[model samples]
Target: MSLSGTRTHLVQTARLNTFVREAGDPSAPVLVLVHGNVSSSVFFDALIEELSDTYRMIAPDYRGYGGSERKTIDATRGMADFSDDVVALLDALEITEPVDLLGWSAGGNIVLQVAIDHPGRVRKLILEAGGSPYGFGGTHGQDGTPTAADFAGTGGGTANPDFCARLAAGDRGEEATSPLTTLRAVYVKQGFTFDPEVEQRYLDGMLATSVGDDIYPGDSVPSDNWPGSGPGTTGTNNGLSPKYLNQRAFADLDPAPPVLWIRGEDDVIVSDTSLFDLAQLGKLGAIPDYPGEDVAPTQPMVSQLRAVLEAAGEVTEIVYADCGHSPHLEHPERFVADVRAFVQ
Candidate 1:
């Protein structure tokens, strides 16, 4: 069959250059997947294939995270900034109707912000290990920091400052390291391990090409998705982009989309943050101020975030049994089946 989906490269002038994948029928529902921190569009390879027969899927390599441009000034990064990319990508595709938004880990919050900011864009939402929003100070304190630290121990494809600087600047198009396969394998096997070919392409596509790696080293994320592309001189010119970690961006948002929360019981990444994390975020220069904050500087605010979502009747909670932060990758069959049911 004509490969279920087609890949297209888009450059909106000097503003953005994004790679988009579309599968299944044009008339079918649209499914958009966003990867968490240190991850790119490659993680959804299996979901794309399984759902390709039904839904049209769109996965974008967030700036500094995938085959997109690197941002030098660090101004291009942030969850809100990434949300903007998602919105732009959809507009470019001429898809104006509500679409199914699925965000794994950090990506979940990205899509959530979009749904909250533009409710018309989403119908159903699936957050696989949807992380807590620690930046906006949801109901906690002065700083926007979540206390939960159970995120999978996967290293960012490359932590080299130079690489981070370039990747953060939004220039993943022609040069970038392949996806971190070593990390992917551990996470995959820990949760939903899959067929090898998908993993190979995923690993290959994340490189910077000069490495002569086996992967394609797609133009997203920090350099090094493919093999042989050793770390290069990416050069960091900016501070962390506000979008990559902006918590206040979601303060005004209360996305009413149907939310499915799937998590594995043993997920170390999903740590139970104390209330202090939220309180700190609220007092930060960005978040609005709250009253009577007495918790020590060490309290985590993840619980408060949970409270916020719980108040939203549209949320559905599912425990991933003994899995870690990535239940979907941990249990792909279950993940796909649940997703299919939710969208249906």
Candidate 2:
């Protein structure tokens, strides 16, 4: 939102012109940050601001989320399509080689898919509480486990307190309409648990950003295909399915690209999983343990990740004690420091 940064346009998925941010020097190594669903590139504002001085960074809002226009009903774009958007954006920027990739939560899943689908394009993989259909370390489940719904109403029910703080800080950047309005919408529409102040700040900051009469452009999304079961499916499969039922979007990975698991112990959504046995530090039935035994990896969360990489002969994992689902957001200094150490 700050006009001081360089802005560039890239065409992706249906020739839709997408906006992206470029910070630091082109000569420096590149870093791409992908955000999660129902959120925009703005989510990475703090991280970007911190990293801009050292590494060249790019963060683009997926269609239907931020400044980008929604996809028309006649068109559609899925996870693969979104990953392709990343590739297209990179190609447009002439990033012919792999760059450090950081995907937070759902964005982490997207980044993993990108690395899996197109190896050699990624130098290092960093997944922040990233969920995968194939389940990494089997710590998460195939269906994300039912416990996730419990968090639905937690954390202010999607009430972004950070966005509120930014607003109070006099940041007129691209903010949601209002913290209160968003909080009300969350309770009414999504059943979230958020504070009114968040909504108030959202409204205040939103007024600062120029928005149309309609703030959300759901009607403009390219794809509305439903899975007919679980989460937001339509049960019809719509020639496509949700993560719970679809693989066309994320392919079955084979010894997938070396992975780095970065998670926060405090994140309820990403850290607290019913499937995980914190005592065992692995899933009950999904992870590999002994050679040819398919035993669960007995390593600690980070150590297990490291063991997985060591077994693969090339991967890295770093865990922050005080971090949550998004260490980059929760512990920016340490997160960026660790990432720079690995990437450089």
Task: Report every candidate's CA lDDT.
Answer: 0.53, 0.49
Q: Write the per-residue lDDT of candidate 2 for residues 1-344, one digit (tens) a residue.
A: 43356454545534456667667888888889887644556556667777777889898866444566544311122245557678878877778988888887667756755775676688777777664332222223333332222111111112234643553354544345444444234212233333444444334423332221122211112222110112221111110112231222323345455556777655444433422222133244333331221322221233322333454445566666755555665567888787777777
Quote each prediction's TM-score.
Answer: 0.65, 0.59
Which segments of candidate 2 are over 4 A away from where they belong? 3-14, 72-78, 135-228, 231-257, 272-313
lDDT of 2: 0.49
Error of 2 at 307 (Å): 9.8
Q: Pick the candidate with the highest TM-score.
A: 1
Error of 1 at 120 (Å): 2.2
Q: What is the lDDT of candidate 1?
A: 0.53
After superposing candidate 1 on the true structure, give the runs of residues whose Cα lies further than 4 Å from its correct spot: 1-8, 11-14, 72-78, 136-198, 205-255, 273-302
Distance from true location, Cα of 36 in model 2, Å: 1.3
Candidate 1 per-residue C-alpha lDDT over 254-308 given as tens digits, one digit per residue, 9 for 90 to 100: 5566778787666544345411122343345323433324421423334534665
